[model samples]
Target: MPTVPPTPSPEVITYTVRAGDALAKIAAQFGTTVEEIVEANEIEDANRIEVGQVLVIPQGAEIPILCPILWPLTMAPTRC
Candidate 1:
């Protein structure tokens, strides 16, 4: 019997925060919301994103893994 391939999942985008970059702007650029970005990134302060900070931008309902260099430690895995 012929086997079927698995469906492709939504892509996870990683963005590096730039100077004067805000959650709102980033969300708009990525076609997402600030709240979603905050939750996906586990950001303590949505307004406190640092320059060069890497962020995970989930395309759909699935959340991807966080950036490894977030804190120089092993970051815990989270579900979608």
Candidate 2:
């Protein structure tokens, strides 16, 4: 049988926690699932996240961050 490769999923966005904000509210505001937020942040306890804690918001689709180092992928490879 021929082997099949798995598809890569989109990356999550990171958000710095703010005072008086809860995970539930953040998840709702981002239109994503809470479980996703928990998993992305690697929270041992979902309720334990605190202010200044960084959380990753798994976006439905990924938008790449612009940087000069990433330019090579768009150009043709030079002969070695």
Can you write out model 2's per-residue Cα lDDT over 1-80, one digit (the tens) per residue?
99989989766567788988888888877777779888877778878778998877886824334445543465665432
Q: Give the clashing residue pairs of candidate 2, or none.
A: none
CA lDDT scores, all candidates in order? 0.81, 0.74
Q: How accurate is candidate 1 locally (lDDT)?
A: 0.81
TM-score of 2: 0.57
- Model 2 global lDDT (CA atoms, 0 to 1): 0.74
Worst-scoring 10-residue span by lDDT in model 1: 61-70
